[model samples]
Target: MKPRLGVPSDLEAVTSAVIRTMPLDPQWDYRFPYRHQYPADHYKFTRMLFEYFLDPSFDDWLVMVAEDSLAPGDSISVVSFGVFDISYVNKRRHGPGYKPQDPVTEVENRGGKTRRDANHKHFNEFWKGQIRAYKKYFAPLGPEQMHLQILGTLPEFQRRGHASSICRWAMDHVLRKSLKDMSVMASPMGYNLYTVLGFERVGTFYIQVPGEDERLVLQAMMYKPKIWETKTTEDGDGACVML
Candidate 1:
């Protein structure tokens, strides 16, 4: 199946698939560990987060999904989805754009049932680590790169290559749009796939609150687009150096 830009109608399935798959990610579990115990509030805030992303007016990201078309112009089963951040690629810088009391952010800040179930005590410090990793490590890569903010495939849909399909879409988009590079915060589950896709691990970073023993680490991977190489020929003309 081909990947397409997601719409508001796709929000539920996209959020569903994400909630199903993200638990395998240690960081996701660390932050939202009560998802299973508090499914209602879990879905409530999770949907809010995804809805914020899929808002038709938000152009900073392109939420791409792979679906199973059940019939001709009928129904679809969204098997997997990805949130690809184009903020840098699109020339719009997001300096922690979320304002105070954003419903989603408030959930992380201990404002409601969602926040009560979340990692209220540690998420703030953990989030600070993420920001430090971004500014100190990722920022130097510049603003012409694309980032895979998050990727999720339903647990039942694993091994179907849906994740790779979305990743390839990002790679194609990078070259297609003349972007310099593509980036991803690779989880342990996706590290090998991104590596096989030609994304090199730039480094690794950790998220931990001081005095806490638990640590969550993730790899920062970057993909350099492949393009035709040109060299000067004997006749002083440029020639393609085929790989």
Candidate 2:
């Protein structure tokens, strides 16, 4: 099978595949954890933000998909990465153009209360704050700050080295230029894959997915360009050079 980078032109198909293959476990006991107790709209608000809006327009973003034309079109595995332009990020943050118009913000501002009811105010506030914190932590990046947002393989495709192939392609295509480092919030099952791919442990935290006990989340791993160097610096120092 061959793999290729997907474009926004494939958004409809990608979105459809995501909805069809995504597990319905409330705790999101899969690759990327998030709440989903209610199938209709647990994360409906933020769905457009990350899966649609952000994924579509981000120039440095990549969606590596494996496919076989003679077979079914379902993506057997995928690795999504984004190299955020820090200048654009800074402008949105510190610059006047920084519009607080993301999905959550809109929901909060329009509904006037997240829970839409007075009794649930406190719970709503707490939950909203938690999600906001996650977004804030994941948002900022220098001009070439790159991150692997999600990587996973279908159970049938495991042990096939498809993930490794995607990672290698990502290193070259997404991190090819001025990107200083690559990072990911690792899933427990993916730790070994990342370690072998040259990522080193960094930190850990607890991620609460609704209906499931809190899981230990690792912010553990960073990929430095120098470590995979096919090129050397003039000064003879080839560490993860700062961007």
lDDT of each structure? 0.77, 0.50
Per-residue lDDT of model 2, residues 6-83, tens digit only: 665555545444544434322233322323444444344334333433454444345666543224775433322222
**Per-residue error at 8 for model 2, in Å?**
3.6
Compared with the true structure, what per-residue lDDT tens digits does model 1 show for residues 1-243? Answer: 888889999888888887788888888778877767878877777787788678766666679998875357967699889887777633544444532223346444454433544775556665677667767757786677777878888887777888899999999888877777888777788899999999999889888878989888788888988775889988999997645
Cand. 1 Cα-lDDT: 0.77
| lDDT accuracy of residue 241 in candidate 1 | 62
Q: Count the backbone clashes (under 3 Å) in each candidate.
A: 0, 2
Q: What stretches of model 1 exceed 4 Å from their correct place?
A: 69-75, 89-114, 229-243
